[model samples]
Target chain A: MTYCVGIKLNAGLVFLSDSRTNAGVDHISTFRKMIVYERPGDRFMVLLTAGNLSIAQSVREILQTEQLKDPGGGEPVSIWNARSMFDATRVLGQAVRHVYERDAEALRHSGVEFNVSMIFGGQIRGEGMRLFSVYSAGNFIEATAETPFFQIGESKYGKPVLDRLVRPETSLDEAAKCALVSMDSTMKSNLSVGPPLDLAVYEVDRFASEKLVCIDMSNPYYRMVHSSWGQKLREAFDSVPDPVWQGATDLPLATESCQHKPLRKIGRPEERLI
Target chain B: MTYCVGIKLNAGLVFLSDSRTNAGVDHISTFRKMIVYERPGDRFMVLLTAGNLSIAQSVREILQTEQLKDPGGGEPVSIWNARSMFDATRVLGQAVRHVYERDAEALRHSGVEFNVSMIFGGQIRGEGMRLFSVYSAGNFIEATAETPFFQIGESKYGKPVLDRLVRPETSLDEAAKCALVSMDSTMKSNLSVGPPLDLAVYEVDRFASEKLVCIDMSNPYYRMVHSSWGQKLREAFDSVPDPVWQGATDLPLATESCQHKPLRKIGRPEERLI
Candidate 1:
């Protein structure tokens, strides 16, 4: 299992991935999942992957040189020379499909589905930023304003915070902070997602990023965020008044303002109904 | 889909379940997942089910009359007559197996797995509180001091809060509050789990529980929890400092205190290697 998130906000893009990979609980290993592609003044992109490591590594290997013939009889398109992020992702999708065509049948015979997902996001020199979640079938969906982030692998445990905090108007640093908090929550709940996180922050139209780093357990900012978030969350929870069992008017838990029916307990154990 | 959680604390027990049931996104309906069996002054138990609605409903129906033979050949043990909460749960397991025998094969022919899971917990007059997570195979595991709660169906989104809060010494109301908060989180992230919700709180050695209620979107308490939690969680998140882009020693995101290899960005896009 893995947890990787890619955020596309008005300010820029944020990508974070944990390095833990496991074939089984006992076969755990560390495999960095984020790969950055930068052409200084031209383009900057990040790819975060999860699922079968073999397939993802294959897709990554093939993606750099994978090409799609332009239907208009122009030069073949590859990630390096694609005019737009959309065409670059098409090259990526083709790479995934190539791997699927090669491995899916053999993997199916061994009872493993050809499962892999990748978060691909960044900017080309000519366009605004784009973020996409590429699926197992090599197809993809671009992130929109309403859903400005995409997460792959062990995603749910970390989702509520992102759902509540991330938006098109969020600042780049804040979105990065939210991603780390999300990852921290995931690491706390899931053992398969672990330390030595790869984080990259890209600023809009810069076509380059300098805010890239590897975070181990001891990273000062992460350690601070992890401890403080837990403590402050507890404080936040404590701040909510406990349920007033007697339905007090001021802070009632069971108020008459509720129009729905209240639950009824079965008063008898032997009571049976089909 | 459903979301149900059962918590066992030294103070008592807490059970909360959402009522949404969906065959598919378009086929969603409301079917309460909690059932209570109370022989007041003798025993009080709540069963929360998730997975195939047919299997769970059948298991619930069979549980009413399902009996396990005693090794000594005394009257067959039923939930009502069981000597302990563990024994009652065993009877419940047998009921699940009975349903599997009758339906699993036929269901499998149509490509549906015999999927069902349950959280059963409460107290009998002679014993302390007990909590068990029962599986479709008619097997179960009890919650322990270190891990004092079990969640079924759409569990991941709600798990982080529970992991942070519930402990043996947590008060009954606090556990109930925690359970509600957990459910609120799940609802926020998952469309399949929604209101109305069933909640019951049992005190230690009580053999009965009076704190049972159904909460809907309009319920004052749930409304308060739903709104307050999002606001407070956002406020909690804001309290944390944003990442320092300049690598300031005071609050740096990329401090030299870290002992992990930093990720190296691919400086050239045309470089390709397998």
Candidate 2:
């Protein structure tokens, strides 16, 4: 299991992924799920993956040299020489297809499915930044302003925060904070998603970023974000007034007759609910 | 899809459920998903349902008359005649199996799985309060002090708060507040679970409860829980400081060379990753 999120905000792109994987409760281990591809002053891209570890490892292993034949007579396009992020993602999709072709049959025989998903986003020298969610079928969808974020793997536990705080106008540093808070909630509820985490931020058009870092339990900023967020959240929850029932106070639940009809309680053995 | 939760606290039991049901996003409708059977001074039980609406509806339809043969050679036991909550749950399980026996094969022919889940909790004369999470196979597990709550259907989004707030010592009204907050989070993230919620609360040793009511968008108390929770959650998120990056602030992400080795970035086309 894994939890990875990539946010494409107007300021830049934010990528965060947990490093834990488990086959079952017994076989738990750490496996980094992020890769940085940067040709300084040219292109800066980050890839985050979730799903079968073997298939992800296979795709990463062969994706480096994997190439796609250009319809026209020209040099084969690879992630390295691709002129646009679109073509770069095509090379990645081809790499995923390559792994599927190589392993799907054998895996099917053993009762396993060939499943993998990825978030690939970055900028090419001549174009604006792009973010894509690549699927197990080698298909992909790009992020747009209306929906500026993509999260895969154990996403729901951490989703409410992302839905509330992230938007196209959110700053790079603020998006980073939202991503860490999202990851913190996920790790608190699910044991499968643990540390150390991999986080990277790319400013729009930089084609290079210095904000690639790893976070373990000991990082000071992360520790503050973790503890402070929990305490504040608890305080916020405690601040909301409890529901006051009928005869106790003046509120909706405080009256015997609410705006809506009350739920019927069967008080007799032979009462017909219909 | 639906979202339903039942919690057993020392003060008593709390139950909450959403009514929205959808076959597809286009085919959405409302159908109440809770049933309360209470005989004052004797017993009180509430049933909350989720999953394949057909199966749940069928289970509910037949459950009223369903009965289980007494292993001790006494009279047949139905929910009405059951002396213990455990025996009552067995009667409910048998009702589920009967529904499965009648519909599972045909449902499989139509490519639908025979799936349904339930949270049934209450008190019976001469016994303590009990709560059970009934599964598709008619099997069930009880809630204990350590794990004091059960959720069915779109559960993950609302789970973190329960993990943080629910305990055996929580008061009945506080548990009801927690349940509404949990439902509010689920509704914010998922359209499949929506308005007109049903909530019920019972006190220890009481066979009936007056805190049974329906809450729609117009209900003032629920409206307060809905709006206040969102505002406080946003405030809590903003209260946490952003991560301090290398050179900007002294933090985990603040140093170019972190305690953990930085993720290796590929800077050249021909760099060997292995």
Candidate 3:
């Protein structure tokens, strides 16, 4: 299992992924799930994956040299030479399909689904930054203003924070911070998503990134963020007033202010359960 | 989909459930998913349901008079006459099995799994309070001191808070508050789990509960909790320092104090993707 997040903001793209892989509780290992592709002033892209290790590894290996035929019939387009991010992602989808063609049938025979998902986001020289969520079927969907982020695997535990904080207007640094916080919550609740995290923060149109780091448990910044966020969250919870059961309290639980009827109780065996 | 949570504490037991039911996005309706069976001085029990609405509805209807054969060869035991909460839950499991026996095959023909899950918790006068998570197969597991609560349906979005805050020592009001906050988070992240929530709080050794409330969006107390919790959570998030990308800042994200190496980049197309 894994937890990986990719956020598309006005400033740039933020990618974060946990580095834990498990076949079962006993067969746990660390595997980096991020790939960075940069052509200096031409294109800068990052791919984050979650699912079967073998398939992801195969797709990553194939994607480097994988090419898609151009509809205009000029030349084969690879991630390196693609004119647009959309075409670059089409090459990635092809790589995924290539892996599936090789492995899906054998995996199905073993009763294992050929499951893999990826987050691919970057900018090409002539176009704006594009973010996509690619599926096990080699199909993909692009992110838009209404939905500015994509998360794959162990996503729900960390989703509330992303829902509350992320928007198209979020800054690059702020989105990175939010992504880390989301990862922190996920790691706290799910042991399968353990550390040494990979983080990449790209500034819009930079065509390169310098803010990439590997964060282990001992990292001072992650440690501080983990402890401070926990303590602060506890404080925030404590600050909320508890429901006052009865009497004239500050915030009464059983007030007539609600338009709905209070819950009905079944005090006898003959009463309706619903 | 639904969201229901039940917590057992030293002070009492707390149960909360939402009232939204959906077969598909177009087929949405409101249906209460909680049931209370209280015999005042003798026993008090709450049943919170999630999963297939028909299955839960059948279980509730059958549970009224459903009986389990006594292994000791006496009269059959029904929830009304069961001496222990364990025996009472066994009767509940039998009720689920009864429904399954009648409906599971037909439902499977329609490609709907006979899916249902329930959180049943309460006190029988002779022994201590008990909490059980009952599965679709009519088997159940009790809550322990380490895992003092159970949640069913759309659970992950709200689980981190429970993992952080719940313990055997948590008070009844605090647990109830926590349950509402948990439900609030679920509702915020998922539209399928919505308002008009049912909440019940029971005190230790008190066979009946006076603290039951139906909270809708218009409820003043719930309104305060919803707004205050959101505000405080944002403030807490703001209080945590953002990652220090570079320089000798107080919380540097890429500090040399950590033992792990920074992420390596692939600068050329020929570099290894692994």
Q: Give lDDT per model, in order.
A: 0.90, 0.89, 0.89
Q: Between which residue pairs do clashes occur in model 3?
A: none
Supply the TM-score for candidate 1: 0.97
lDDT digits (tens) for residues A137-204 of candidate 2: 88999999988999999999999888877889999999999999999989999999999999999999
- List where candidate 3 sits over 4 angstroms from the true fold: A246-250, A257-261, B257-261
lDDT digits (tens) for residues A138-170 of candidate 1? 899999999999999999999999999999999
Checking candidate 1 for backbone clashes, the offending pairs are: none
Off by over 4 Å in 1: A255-261, A267-270, B269-274
TM-score of chain A in every predicted structure: 0.96, 0.94, 0.95
Which tens-of-lDDT digit does each residue in B76-187 have in candidate 2?
9989889998988998899999999999999999999999999999999999999999999999999999999999999999998888888899888788999999999899
Where is the poorest 10-residue window by lDDT in model 1 chain B?
Answer: B265-274
- Superposed model 2: Cα runs more than 4 Å off: A247-251, A254-261, B247-251, B255-260
Best-to-worst order by TM-score is 1, 3, 2
Best by TM-score: 1
- TM-score to true structure, per model: 0.97, 0.95, 0.96
List each candidate's DockQ score.
Answer: 0.68, 0.59, 0.68
Task: Report how far off residue A179 is in candidate 3 (Å).
Answer: 1.5
Report the candidate with higher lDDT, 1 versus 3: 1
Q: Candidate 3, residues B160-244: lDDT per residue as tens digits?
A: 8898888999998888889998999999999999878999999999999878888888777788888888888888888888778
